[model samples]
Target chain A: MTDFLYNYLHVYLFVALFMLFCGIVGVVYRRTLIGMLVSLELIMNGAGLNLVALNRFVSPENAYGTAFTLIIMGIAAAEAAVALGIIILIFRKYRHIEGGDLREMRD
Target chain B: MNFAEIIFLFIIAVTMGGAATAVLAGSVVYAIMGLVVTMFGVAALYVYLNSPFVALMQILIYVGAVTVLIAFAVMLVGPLYRRPKEWTTAGKFGAALGVALVSLLLFVRFVTETFPRAGAPSFEMTTKDIGRLFFDDLVLPFELISLLIVVAILGAIMLALFARGNK
Candidate 1:
């Protein structure tokens, strides 16, 4: 795919920026904890895209970008697993997973 | 456009569309579905980036595992009802849009100004190269990542047990 956008860094960067945008807006607007978690995944993926894009475009000779991307995926998987577990626990205690209801901290 | 270019464009559309659905969907179940699509789209992009190994891992780890985990949480957490309203007001939403635009401008400028143009590479990094790297120069970070994963898994299990009220 020797398309202009595919070969260049501009499209990738814009896509990453859009991912970050969606993530932030989702975090702010999402009512459910699980929705926020989904948004968080987008944010993490955005970071990974940035890494790989720069790796391909800026320093084509190195694998650090790809390595960091692998690490990011690992961390993201860990984060999603942990966050989802916490969401389930909160739902168990409160009977719902909406963020608006979890205002006051309690045992 | 050529076939490959068309496919690339399609992938980008899938990614953007999926992300939009994920963020704007009314229910978490639908949101997870959108996320899975987005994950696949991103993995495809990785192929275009000349890192097929990362692309495979992206599909394996993201589309295979993470979305499944999210789907499980979605199923377990509560009844999936349509969200009636958002906690955000016009003011807040406007503020978020403002932040997004401002940050976009800044970051775009930074990258365009700083990063130099790159040409075609002589060698494409492969899975074997990555594996060799894991054992050679990147061993330390590799081991650290494994340790982090172990901790995360243990923590998740503990949390899930707590949720079961069977400590």
Candidate 2:
């Protein structure tokens, strides 16, 4: 446990896997669009951490991995904006944002 | 693990717990708060990786912008705090089994693949190196990414406007 924790890679990998687990659970259990969006962000952040970790430890000079992580953040910001707008629209039209209850498009 | 490793491990544990709580908590607001803690942990990890610039950016972009946006969305949308009466058994079981199995597999892979590649640690790839790379080999993509961010912002605004007008 001591050796594992001291090493930088261990912390990085642990965080990634743990975040991924949280994301999966959030996806499975969350009923609101906002909650789901939060989960999605968790997933993206996990991936971003992985990129930074790999870049730092294994391939420091390349810098592509870190750059990609930033790009992912950019994408996530845009995604959140658009998703929130859609969620609002859904709420305005249907009066609720519950994933289970908002089954209007089931056809 | 050494004393330093132990301390870091403690931090990592807290981070994971916070992340789990953020996603699985009953209230949407608490979940978002948990996400803030998780973001802090990720930033810490960035620091551990020898990139204070990325760590600062992580905090600024994720903790500042993203968390604020999520909070705003939660406030504007109703039912965010209203707890559902019940979750189906299937939902609970599936999520539990899913996380357990995935974590288990990942642990195995982690143990197996980690030992062989314990290469020597290199220089502290400091902020200067990052800036150099940003201007040198990575110039084009860096500019393109900014453009993509702009497009995403515009598209989001357009969608919101269109949805409002239709309603």
Candidate 3:
């Protein structure tokens, strides 16, 4: 069992894919801004997982995967900060953060 | 199952369970808590993949910083009456679940068939090597990312202050 896991790349790939799917579903199904943000983080993580897995199982010589994943983490942190800031601002303006109520541009 | 496999399985379960909770939980606070679990589990998976440095950063940045930021956002938004807003109808829920399942099955089949089963040779990637790569090969992007963070911090503060002023 250990060998099957540590020796196989597909396992990690499958897990990452599952995570991405979950994130997509969450994004579509969620109504609130914060909930959607959380799902977006999940999707980012899934991508990071896939990158590291491919790095480990496809190209072990270079530290490219790890570095790339670090870059992704940085980007995700910035995204979360900006997103939360926007959410806070929206809440202050509208007094609520529901998706349905954010239809100001609708004619 | 050997010790390592058991641990791997456990980590996967935790990761998936946490993600499920984060997405499915009714309360936003509970969803953030579940996100914490999922972040830690992903960090653990990084360790298993032989990148302990990334794992540590994952824990530090994601579990420590990002989760705290989210929690603060939740607190700032004030108390919320747990409303069944996300999945208001059973039909919507069922449709989303059906799409997720179908996509998952297709992805699994494509990956298993296309990707070669023979794993690449393993190698130890020390923190020093990662640092060297960051400084040497990825210096430009690294510096740019740092700049991005600085800008983001300033923007967040400005936006918050502006919002307060408008009130």
Evaluated with lDDT, which candidate comes out highest? 3
Query: How are the candidates ranked when ordered by DockQ, highest leading?
Result: 3, 1, 2
Task: Report the C-alpha lDDT of model 1 over B1-167, residue by residue, as the tens digit.
Answer: 67778899999999999998898887677788888888889999999888888889999999889998988887786566644543446776677778877887898898778765544454488888788877899999889888988999999899877767742
DockQ of each: 0.64, 0.50, 0.70
Q: Which ten residues in a row have the lowest lDDT in candidate 2 chain A?
A: A1-10
**Which residue pairs collide in model 3, if any?**
none
TM-score versus the correct structure, for each prediction: 0.92, 0.87, 0.93
Whole-model alpha-carbon lDDT for candidate 3: 0.86
Docking class of 1: medium
Please give the lDDT score at residue A88 for candidate 2.
75
Model 3 Cα displacement at B57 (Å)? 0.5
Superposition error at B91 for model 3 (Å): 3.1
Residue B55 lDDT (model 2): 85
By TM-score: ranked, best first? 3, 1, 2
DockQ winner between candidates 1 and 2:
1
Which runs of model 3 end up more than 4 angstroms from their true locations?
Answer: A105-107, B82-86
lDDT of model 3, residue B83:
51
The candidate scoring highest on DockQ is 3
lDDT of 1 at A83: 86
